[model samples]
Target: MTAHGRLPVVYFPEADERLSSWAARMAPFYAMTVSEFVAALGLKGHDVFDLEWRLSEGQGALIAARTGLSPEAVQAMTFRELGAAARMMIARKSRSACPHCPEDLHRKAAAQPWRFRCKVHGVEFRDATGETLSDRFGADCFKKLEGHAEAGAAHLDAWACGAGQGDLKAPEVLQVLTARHRRASPPNVDEQPRMSLKDRRDYQDFLTTPILRQALTVVVPEYDQAAPVLAKPVRPGLHALAQGSLLQCFALTVGIGRIIEDPVKWAISVMLVSDAEGQGRVRQAISPWPLSLKRRISARFWRAERDERARQSAEKAARQRQSHKYRLIQSHKYRYRIS
Candidate 1:
């Protein structure tokens, strides 16, 4: 059985022919034949058919290097014991679906993970509530979604489980999720539309529900939290909501009317969710509606205020000029004007 945050266990019957095939696929990577690889691993007291690791490919590679194995072998091993290792990995990778709403603003500044409580409606994941957000996200997707670690753990897990839902085939799922999120978002008065705290909460809640979350879990069974030594930090916008980087840019769809501008660049950034079928030049990159995005909105408001001020100033200046001219004419005509 799978334990939370551990690799899924595979229970391939000893008599299965796939066992030999699994070994064969892994042999070249490990510099051995199927029999040699199995014998080598078995000699090392590792259940070659049941070995498991987190979803980090680098980590898997590291483990393989240390064990004198190859990347392919490590992955194959994860798949071979797909029963127990896979379950353990998934349980450990669940993320909290709660939205920290209004107060979320403050929590983001402190940069603390657990300080914020549920501020928005429908932020709760449980209808269990005992599970911490950390526990919910487990260890895998939590890091990647946050941009702290890599984002392909789900693909790796799929491979290990023989789930046939690897990197090449996972976009459809992401597209659907992204679409749902887009449809629920409301338009703003300005050119750019930002998701409100309430909308984000509702969408997040729906995402964590069993229907979608389970599908993701099936497609991506294991995740890794460790970042590679050279891995770059995640951009603030792409960072997940849990990190308080709202308005993560997903897709850049064309403006049917005036609502959307810069469709080409926006679409490129969202390439993760779109496929060749929807491919186009990046019109613009729509990032999360953070302070930066709000600047434009604030600027528009400021410009309007400034324009009104300018108009009032002009009117006041004109009145003053008229008064001064009238006073001068009166003074010229009558020497004792004040009296």
Candidate 2:
């Protein structure tokens, strides 16, 4: 191979690997930046920017010749052939990468917005630049959360395919679920220290929106109302918050999964439907199920909602009674002479 042809053999692409990530890994073998590598292939401007789109025949030939791979192999590696709806699932930003992966290997699935942990290593995914999003947070929570992501993805795909009728858009559903997670587990000390004051305040507001709170309650019937802690300094609340966030995220995904037919099958397939012991874990993950075991949990949630309304009503009545009594007292005082 010539000096210009000194590219690494294309790393075997994972099921969901992005073409961009593959290019990034190949860049080092050629001793060039990813952009430089793509530009050298004669792709210009926007073509270089959009790696998911299939390369032109000439561009494919150029890369094939340089890498000593067939044009068919080059084409197979690109995600550009996937349907438009499928492409939306790929995150535009490289949100996470696998820490345990070889230096030259980055799993494309990790970069997807819905994925939380590395499938192979069972570790928390890192941010685009390969830094932990929260040092205090552990991978265990994310691993648990990932078990439910398949269910979430199913719902998302269904919606994208126009299978459901709902007021919420697909993006809104994801945002609401993420907000629920943020609320259930507010940023701990490790996460807060990295944020600016304004960002912290904004994050607090984002988590506490009325819609998010309602969504949280719907998904997690056992959820308790936790007051915002933005005014206070960050403290050591990592473990509890991590666990809460994981549960919340998983609950939200299960709730989304409930909309599909045969929800139990969907949930089970996403989790442990095969193993008997694992089935118990799956049940625990999707507890307070408004779908599976609907009668018991649904009744419980209804009772809780009724009790909340009654409590509010009692409080309003008590305030009204006090106001009426005060008015009567004032009337009597006005009728009588000044004491």
Candidate 3:
């Protein structure tokens, strides 16, 4: 189709490919850098940097002539023409590229913060260079987390969507639940303000063990089965493992409805006090904890809640001040307007 009578490489952009990524792929086939390829097409200046810009009909025709693709095909690859969902999921930074993606194809879905796995490969998505914790802990250890992968993904999606909608209560419950579980775990001897490499490796190993996995399993069982297991006498050095597992389960299972109902108070009361005292009747329950421990946990939750409320109040005040200033400025600007 070109005046030189040479056809460009017959390459079709992948569904997830960005305009720049597709150009990068085509550049290698033509023995040119991506910048050079853009230059060859007479797309000078900022046009080369405008990766998401829609191609005009003239621009599309010119690109088609040089690349041996239909003008429509080039337009299809442009991001500005993509549907709303696709646009929302587009990656602005190159770091969003999936390292494990075959042929180095950038994925649009990878742009979502909640998307941790490459669905096609069934592997956790690594950074742009394709590295993961498995490189250090070994593949076997990494596989432990994979067992809960489906639930974890769904939980993350729900949490992300809820957070995006300004619903903070669910996330707050998750934070409290995880903190309680983490407190039950044995203290790391190497714990410091900043963890050393050894401490990090040890922590990773700790999380991958069977004890934690068993605790997470408790979440899926019915209340009767779960209560008996939780009631078992705590063994020395195993408290942390049990707690960590329970925390992960709560994080992955607690829904917005439970959060709205303020179940944290009921759950904590039940876990720390026997049903006879906390519920006015004996029921399936964990052995009561020391009164002091119960008070400490309750106080921590209240303190966190108070701090969050203060933070929200401050933000609202700031917004109101800004709005008032904007109205004042607008009123002055309209002072001389004709009545």
Candidate 4:
């Protein structure tokens, strides 16, 4: 339908260019909209945007034949080669953009959370407002997690590409990191009665956030000193973060590296500072860890539980003895009836 009976217009896909981007660019040459161009090719029930990640071989071949490009080249323009892991991490819309490239020429990697730089230009990506990862985390603070993010990014990229199926998956690591380590501390500011009505009411609302007087502070204990303030009982997990902002992805990337160093140690250390519920949460959260690692964690967890029970039992006995002595003293006083 496009330039009928004439030779196909020659248009090459940019390196790492998304299939959607190529079709869009070529659409105007034939005076057709992207959707019309795709429809004319007979790929019905297929969204133009999804072509980046979900194109079938038949569809790829059809596009190739119409565009005068090989099927392999057409497939390369999609996420077909990146594997499903990258598919899960790909944002529905671009999260960051390359400063040097035109908006229409963004690469496929730009939509992937693991990629911090432009695959085509080798430049760091920036948010819509021109904020880079370094800016979100100040240059000095970013320096702390940058190394971990780099190494973790590589590890994650390799794992997603099916390189390390035997190792722990990224989602498990993130959930384990989210296990609450420390109880929430009282807000730094105090709520005193007799304050203005507005102030007192605000304070009341803060404390009474439907609470059993427990302020649950869910956090990554290792990043306690640096991570941004997070909402209570809400920890960063892979699903909550797969399409997250650059900063969120960066944090998870650092966490992936930090825990991989000694996953068991991190789990135990987090358990130590947590309450009974928090500890139990960790015990359950680690169920997906590899078998050998799971055994080691379980052994340590049971030992710690036994020790805590023994200590509590000893304290209960001491309290009973003290209560008995106090009763005897009261009976003696009643017998004497002295002033």
Question: For candidate 2, lDDT tens digit of each residue in 68-139?
Answer: 767877776665544455454454444456777765454555434445567688776665445542332335
- lDDT, candidate 3, 233-276, per-residue tens: 12222122223222222223332223234344444433332222
Error of 2 at 245 (Å): 11
Model 4 agreement with the true structure over 110-143: per-residue lDDT tens digits = 7777777787788778876798867765677777
Q: Judging by lDDT, tell me the better candidate of 1 and 3.
A: 3
Best-to-worst ranking by lDDT: 4, 2, 3, 1
RMSD of 1: 19.7
Task: Provide the clashing-pair count of each candidate structure.
Answer: 44, 0, 2, 0
For 57-169, candidate 1 gives per-residue lDDT tens digits of: 76455545445445665555343344342332221112223443321122111221121123334343321245433354554544333331112333433533558652232
- Model 3: which residue pairs collide? 184-240, 185-240
lDDT of 4 at 93: 55
Q: Could you tell me every candidate's TM-score relative to the true structure?
A: 0.18, 0.48, 0.39, 0.72
For model 4, the run of ten residues with the poorest summed lDDT:
211-220
Winning model by TM-score = 4
- Cα displacement (angstroms), candidate 4, residue 245, comes to 1.5
What is residue 254's positional error in candidate 1, in angstroms?
A: 18
TM-score of 1: 0.18
TM-score (C-alpha) between model 2 and the true structure: 0.48
In model 4, which residue pairs have backbone atoms overlapping below 3 Å?
none
Q: Comparing candidate 1 with candidate 4, which one achieves the higher lDDT? A: 4
